[model samples]
Structure formats: C-alpha cells, structure tokens
Target chain A: MRRSMLFIPGNTPNLLMNGDVLGSDAIILDLEDAVSPAEKDSARILVRNALKHLHYKGCEIIIRINPVDTEYWQKDLEEVIPLKPNLIMPPKVSCAQDVKTVSDYIAKLEEKCGFEKNTVKLIPLIETAMGVENAFQIAGADERVAAMFLGGEDLTADLRCKRTKEGNEIFYARTRLVCAARACGIDVYDTPFTDVDDLDGLYKDAQFAKSLGFTGKASISPRHVEGINEVFSPTQAEIDYAHEVMETIRIAKEQGKGVVSLRGKMIDAPIVERARQVIEMEKAMFGGVEDDE
Target chain B: MKITANAVAGTLESSDVYVKVEPCDTLEIEIESVVYNQFADDIKASVKEVLDELGVESGRISINDKGAIDCVIQARVETAIKRAGGNK
Candidate 1:
C-alpha cells in the first residue's frame, strides 16, 4: 500500500500531469464525486487519454469511476478499463454481489481486450453505513480485490452527523471497516485529510490511522503526499534496528541458541515477523528489483 | 549517437545483437539477445542497475538475448540511451 494516494480532480489536465511530477506513489483520476455530471463524459475522455499516454513511471494508476449501479457506469467501465490501469476503485459497493459484478465484467473485458487475465484489481470503497455493514462480503467478493478504503465525508453525510476533528463519531465505522478487511485478508485505507494546509493535523491523523492498522491514507493535495510518506516510511533508524534484530536471530539460530537478545530485548517470533514485514513493505513501497520470472 | 533496433525473446541460431530507439514512457533501453542461461540472470541485473543508476527508469525496454559480453551489454544500453538524449 502507498503511504499517500494523490487524487486529481478528473477535469483538470494540469493536475493530472502533476501527479507523476509531484512524487506520489499512486495517482487516482477521480471521475465520480469530484466531477460534475455535466462534465463527467469529458472527464472520462481526459482520464482515458492520460492513462493511455501519460508517463507516470512506478505510479499505480487508479480510476475512481461512478458507482456500478448508476446509468453511466457501464460506459465508464468500457471506456476506461480497456486502458489497463493498475486498478479500478468502484464507489458505493454495497455487497459481495456488487464487487462480483465488476469482477466478472473485468474478467470478460481482459479476454476481449487481450490483456492478461486479472491484471487489474478492484478497490471497493465503503462510503455509506449500509456498505460498512456489508464490508466483509464486499471485500471478499473478488479474488482480485486488493484493499478497502473508508470514504468518511460521504459516509458522514449519509449518516447525517457532523464529522468531528478527532473522527470520534466515525470510530466505530473505521474499526468495523478495518476488521472486515483484515478478516478477508485485504488492506484498509483511511480517508484523506481534507485540510491540505493543516500539515501537522494531517500528520497526526495519519499517524493515528497507522496506529489503528490502516495501511495508508489518501491525500487531497499534492503537498500532503510528502508528509504522509514521511509518516508512513520506516526511518533509517527503524530500518537499521529491524535489520540488526533479524541478523541477530539468524546468527543465534545458527549457533543453536533457543533464545537471543538484541539491545536488551529478546528476539522472538513476533519481533522477527515484524522485521520481515517491514522489509517486505519497504520493497513493495519502493520499486525494489524483483527478478522477472 | 543514434540507435535503431528491435528485440524478441527466443533462441538465436548465432550470436546476434539488435538495438532500437523508440518513444518510451518508462523504458530506457532494452536488450533482447540469447545468452548462456548461467549468465543471463546476472547480466540482466547488472544492466538494470546501470540503467537505474543513470536515472533512466522509464522508456520502451525490450531485450533479445544472443549471448553477449558484459561490455557489449553496457555499450549497447549506453548507446541507446544516448540516442534518446540520455547522458552518454
């Protein structure tokens, strides 16, 4: 999961172009809520052209299309999915069956388009209370589903509550979303910090979200990407400590020692696993070289 | 320096080297030549590292193997990137 997924309003070409230049690991060309219905088709064409032509190396491209249940969805899918983006973030996914529908269409489209089967994944966003209740079923509906994102502002509106600074009102929903995703073995992403100028606030919120096991957060502004990445990245100190712990364990095992201590802390199963996860995440987050098989 | 070549993945009857320069979003240069299996993996890694070090991460990259030397591989990639206005 990326530390921050930068979202570009679908109608702005310059914003789309800056997505790669601004250093976000992933860029979402949003067509659903950010775009007005009057400009939705134009937004689709713009996003399609960008996907087919833009030079965004190593940036995962996600297109947030309109809800599948809407009248415009099929055309949106037909026009954009063929471009073969990294993933499609379907909004307002209500159940297992909802995701399955998109998954089935994607499979057929891959065959028809001559792209690799299952090359594109689905990110079903839970934006309503009903969707939150059905989160597990929705997340597990497709094998190609990668992550579930909490769409808080929309969700709050649906729930008819004013969102709080600490997000206390949405705590239950956030925890529920995380549990559902984890139960189904998928990643859960937190909603963006809407206040782009509030860098400290964004960092605090992102850190809090990370503590709660949300893998990453979304960003509304390009400026937010750096801060989010900073919060999520393993500092050199952490990385080095993890490496030391891992090496100590390996050495101790080679020496046939049942127990090992590194810097007064016992090296054990959980610690070793955490270290390994850190390493793996670093590899995933950064474009580490993997031999093409 | 100008480069023009294309490569495909398959066995080569004799050792051959083909190169090309095309517009690539991420591929800097790709070399497709038949190489000894024992050295193929190492050669690919070395070439990728060199390209990465040179800050050429995006472009059309296609490599066809024909059992070339490390020197030949370096020369070919450098030649191709230079043709694409990359630092020679």
Candidate 2:
C-alpha cells in the first residue's frame, strides 16, 4: 500500500511536525544524505524524540539510516531501533552480506530491547552496481527484508553514466530489480523522480515504473505524492473488470464447472490472480468499498 | 553529571529550538522563545526534565526557541548536554 514514500529531512522540525498531513502513504525520515555531518548527532536525537512523541497517522514510518560502511549507521540504528519504526532503509546495500549484517544487528537490538524478534523490517536500497548485480541474493538474504528499493541516482553514478530525465540508462536496472524482487516474492520500489517540478514527467515516470511491476515509487517532494498514488492506484475501469471477473468465477463455481470464461475469453489462474490483485489494491486504496451491484 | 565542555545543538529554524550548554558550578537555564508568554514555563519544565534525566547537576543552559514543543525542547537539550560530554 506504499504508493508514495516521501523523504523528509530528519533534522527539519517544521516538516517533521506536519509529516502526517502530507498525503504520502509512507514518510522516510532521511538521516543519511539530508543531514550534514555535523548535524548527524543532533538529527538522530531529534528523530528519536519525534518518533517517541509524534504520531504520524495513516502513514508507514521509515527511517533511512546511513549506509553500513559509515561510522554513523550503528549509532543511527541504536537510536531509532528502540522506537520501532515500520521499516529501516539501509542505503547503498551492496550484497547479501550487507543485508545480513544489518539484519543480524537489528535482531540483536530487538532482543536487547525486549521487543519481538524481527520487529523492524528492512527495505534495502540497492543503489550500486554490485548491489544491482546481487539484487536477488540480497532480497532473499534475510527474512526481515520486507522489500527492495532502487536508487537510480546512485546506481547511475556507480555505472559511470549521466542520469537523464528520460531514464533510458536506468531501464535495465529497474527491470532487473523488479525481476529479482519478484523472484524473492517481495515488493520492489522505484527511486524518486528527482525533477520535482515536472508533474508531467513524474506521471510518465511513475507509469513506466508501474508497467515494469514496481510496487510503488518514492518521492523527494510532496507535490509528487498525489500523482504517484494516482498512477499506482487501480483505476475505476480496472476495478470494475476485476469485479466482473470475480462474479464470473463465482457463477462458474456455483455451476460446478471446472472451466471459467469472461467476455468470451477463458479466465485462467493467472488472470484470476491478476484480478484479485487489482481488487485488493482497490480495497486498500478506497477503504474496501463494495463494488456496485 | 558534570558538563565537560561547551556544546550546542539544534537550530534557530521555525518549530525548532537552539540549545547551548556550558560548564558551570550551578545549573542555570535561560530561554528566549517565540511563544514565551504562553509556553515559557512548559519549555523550562521540558529542559529541566531532560537535564534531570541525564543527571546533569550544574551547567549554564541557554535556549533560543522558535515555537518548539516539549519533545523538541527535550531532544535539543539532551543533545546539547550529550555533545557537551557530560561526565557520568
């Protein structure tokens, strides 16, 4: 249900106070790139306090800690893990070992805090060339991995290529991540469309990601949340078709028939599954409203 | 705990508080908040709460608040004290 995960700078109190009202399905409190080195300690404390006191209604809380290679990451984990955010996005994860390292550390922290084991899930940011190459292994590395996230900006940088607005360069990475996450039976998210002002471009990019089977898209700007949500949400036509498909299957089942057909075309298992997915998405987005009889 | 050095945390941004801690023989807190008339006592109480939790006995604590709430005040004060290297 994470259609749009908006990144909020960890140290900015103004944004943190109003995060819940921003219309994003999830909000990433960014502690990695958003906060300067000097402010890292301060930002950690601030984020910790915000999590403890503030209630972010109806949005998944994700804390994007610094990469595992840095000195700041462990401190970041120690501070936020106790507060129990919905997910922790480890940036620049390169392989299965990296995911293991974070996961193992979290397991220990969860135990030490007297919380349930694996209470905090991970969404690894596969941003580097090595990460993309080992995306499958990384996604399957630990049971704590709830999803995978593509970092196009860092991936392109690692690939020594210019990241154009058209995203011709990242097409392969996007598809590869989708395949890898799908193989692991986990959700995958696309990177933020960095050009915040271009709504048309955002829509196109979101649609492209959706077509490639991305579960959702991340956004650095609040302006893109509505558009991303719209792109990922099931359309009225799709909802209606899914309802018709389900109705057709119900009638066929009542007739004790092994075969089912919809609109003169055979409706097989794959089609039925797709229809259920569409219906599920519709319910999640629209509060499980019953279809018109 | 004793404040070992001068340290500052937070910023003068809106909905935030800038906190500074310095070594002193007696604990003293000075606050200048945008909402001083309404929430100054609550802000002071928040600062004292963090200071007491950190076992801070003596320091010159100064705060420049820009309409920050209790949690923010507590966080900034705690951060400033920790950055000051309080000897536990």
Which digits, one per residue and each the tens of the lDDT, describe model 2 over residues B2-64?
699999988898999999999999889998989999988998898999888888899999999
lDDT of 1 by residue, A1-293 (tens): 57678889875655765678777778888999888886565567557756766678868888898998787676678878888988899998878888988888888888889988889998888989999999988888888899999988998998999887688878887899899999998888899888878888998988888888887888889888998888888777877777788789778878999999998988889888777777766677665634211
lDDT scores for all predictions? Answer: 0.74, 0.92
Give lDDT: candidate 2, residue B5.
Answer: 97
Clash totals, every prediction:
20, 0
Give the C-alpha lDDT of model 2: 0.92
Question: Candidate 2 recovers what fraction of true contacts?
Answer: 0.79
Docking class of 1: incorrect
Which DockQ values do the candidates obtain, in the order shown? Answer: 0.01, 0.66
Over A60-174, each residue of candidate 2 has an lDDT whose tens digit, in order, gives 9999999988989989999999999999999999999999999999998999999999899999999999999999999999999999999999899999999988999999999
Off by over 4 Å in 1: A284-293, B1-88
